[model samples]
Target: MLDANIKQQLKTYLQMLRHPIELVASLDNSAKGRDMEALVLEIAECSDKVTVKLDGDHAVRPSFAVAKAGEAGRVRFAGLPMGHEFTSLLLALLHVGGHPPKVAPEVIEQIKGLKAPAQGGHFETVISLSCHNCPDVVQAFNTIAALNPAFSHVMIDGGMFQSLVEERKVMAVPAVFDQAGELFGSGRMLLEEIVARLDTNAAEKDAEKLNAKGEFDVLIVGGGPAGAAAAVYAARKGVKTGVLTERFGGQVLDTLSIENFISVKETEGPKLVAHLEEHVKTYDVDIMNLQKANALARTDDGKLAVTLENGAKLTSKTVILSTGARWREMNVPGEAEYRNKGVAYCPHCDGPLYKGKRVAVIGGGNSGVEAAIDLAGIVSHVTLFEFDSKLRADAVLQNKLNSLPNVKVILNALTTEVTGDGTKVNGLVYRDRTTDETHTVELEGIFVQIGLLPNTDWLKGTVALSPRGEVEVDAHGKTSLDGVFAAGDCTTAPYKQIIIAMGEGSKAALAAFDHLIRH
Candidate 1:
């Protein structure tokens, strides 16, 4: 199953194992089962410390567990951990084999201190191999299960386990579940976010710690490309800098392919985010993740005060707002109710879930057309709807979209309401703007790729905003407030691109520093 180069890489990684490990597989007589068995055996051949056993009687067929020798397994995979999940598999092997994970010391301690519920903590995450977000969540749970035996986790490939996906009504990637019901909400989540959800006192403790921190000379209020660049520039200027964000990588984490990042010919979102984080870490910037800014204001003492959702208040001499934007949602009735059930935003992440199924793509812009084209390959058919009289996508994309045999496009069509059975999507309602007529199309999924909205709702009254709710900034990235600046998609920047965001962030940082010295 693994190529020669991959085998060599796996052997190198296996050399880091401090103790012996075993791959215990439960397989049937099917072809997939045979493939799984061969994969385990191949992995065993790479390291003497690794052993394979095909005597596992797991309830899920074609499944396997990576366990320390002579110990019960806590991390299991119900499907082949390939594609984006390959890293997760390697990390599980190394971690279960007594190799230390690259997690924070406090987080490791937190995992070790978790108290399992009376029913025991068993997590099952439904994921698609194509999803870029699934690996982080899988690795997070795997790390927890490996660190503390009290918790166990299983990674289930939704594409392979169609019955399980239907039973759980999961239509999105990385859908997590526990004994009771849904554990945490779907989408990308970090280990800290998962722990905070499990530990009731975690948020309070974090808030207290944040409140005790000293004021920063250049405090950034986001951790996307813009925020990272701002932090780097500010720290390089010999100023105390801090970055507070809900997550280190903003909407960029959900992005799949990024080919227009200037010098970099092509790259993936998570990979770029990792490099950005590593570069930021080389500076003296204080990086704080999983913290949401609830409010922003200027204190009476001439300092900017940013309050977090956890009730922690931080003061800074100057602040840069780069909270970024999120995918705009369809405001129809059933859209919100069936968000992850049938209504998804990222086509690249969730396209695999609807294989051989009919789905609809809303919007006729570049993102929407691209989504329809991408879905046409994985899904049985795609119906694209546009409210405008003509498509807004580029000529090249429009031509390509029109050439897809499995894709259909409709102009002057407005999405009215998403139709679904109480559990999952069944159909959709739309209106023909040209004829004032309504129509419904039966489908299993819906992909919305309209646009993005700025993450500046919390700064409504504190700063000046455009009619579209974007932060109004000057040419130099200066906001309405003297000491406050804005950049990235959250600001009134002409274009929302990674390189543009970084440049604006650097400019905002320099502007803030200049203000500091003049005062």
Candidate 2:
């Protein structure tokens, strides 16, 4: 049943509905099947422009297709659309009704380039109905399919296809696979990643021509908040600025909520990223999304040269490093396989997706405790597992976690494996130290918040790195290298907050601008 508030919202959003649309529900006539039909009918009642039709197709049971009247829809949801996926359903309806896409121009171009005389490929994204991150990945793939007829896609609900989940060893949501049955990736993937997966050679060839010989006054490596900020500042100074990022938003996109951004009372990671991307677009910064900096070197002319993974070389007078940090995995069995499906590192990104589902937090430190506290409000229950005998979090954080009625803390419990059904997380196995007994807890998700790992593997011998691998920088964001600066979580900044990263990025840009003027 639809909530009163949500019903009103849908009415307002669907007022622009053009051309009658049909929601074809394929059912098995089971209890769940009847409920699915009712849900579709309820949605149809929201507006006269939409209608529900039933088909007793057991193969596509619990699935629904949204298409214009008298047409077979290309967009199909092979499972229930609930939780965060509800918004995705709403957005799809809007898109089908002449609402223009919000995909980046470069991404659209890539999709167009993939077009061929014959069908090129197919991408299937496996998702859970509650997964908030699943919608973005689904929408991204849908956008590609809509743009180019050469490709096609379907959003498969992991819960509905248990056999396929088991075959793929799916442990997370938003897992993408190709027509060849090869797993492309899991988690919240960028559009560029999908494009690259579609045509690796073409992606490389395209990167080769992306200003391989052009010189810039300032080139920022990494696409997090810091790098984005630095690029904006340098570009505003009228310098030839460029940004190389594997993905824009960095770890910030993994973050779920933000209340400490200073001026703003509250915001989410994706919203902040949208603002950041919009801000970056306001400038002439040459943003090379999905580009990775492979190696760094000094040219004969005393300029900095950054070699990309695609073999393209970008030479610049100054370079700013804003490569951010990543989550440290538990490295246990099923951890990697289940990533994003049921095992998540970013609680903020995936927590709400697990609403009313039991989840486990591996670790009893500050991050683990904080995650447990956050999940308590959104999930049915939270279980904290610590390898050590006692929690390492501060007294205040521990007190806060203790206040949560649905949270359980298990100390000296070593996680042995992340066990799950073929489709989603179902339980966790751990070993109790004192009793030497193994225990299994039934849960739907696991959030690993043990530690943060800096993205500086490529900079091993190129720069002065701290023992922890963070780039060492000074007050002015200067590194050991004369013409190189670093900022954000990748640098040895005292803090790793978004606002701190942005400030450091501004400092690095100002320093780079100063170097150009004084040199």
- The global C-alpha lDDT for each of the candidates, from Candidate 1 onward, is 0.93, 0.83
Encode model 2's per-residue lDDT on 157-220: one tens digit a residue: 8766777776786656678887778777778887677777676476667666775548999999
Clashes of each: 0, 8
Residue-level lDDT for 405 in candidate 2: 96
Model 1 lDDT tens row, 159-258:
8789998888888888998867654568898989998888879989999999999999999999999999999999999999999999998888888899
CA error at residue 506 for candidate 2, angstroms:
0.7
Pairs clashing in candidate 1? none
Q: After superposition, how far is residue 286 of candidate 1 from its true place, in Å?
A: 0.8
TM-scores across all candidates? 0.99, 0.84
State the displacement of the C-alpha of residue 349, model 1, in Å, after optimal TM-score superposition. 1.5
The list of candidate 1 runs beyond 4 A from truth reads: 181-183
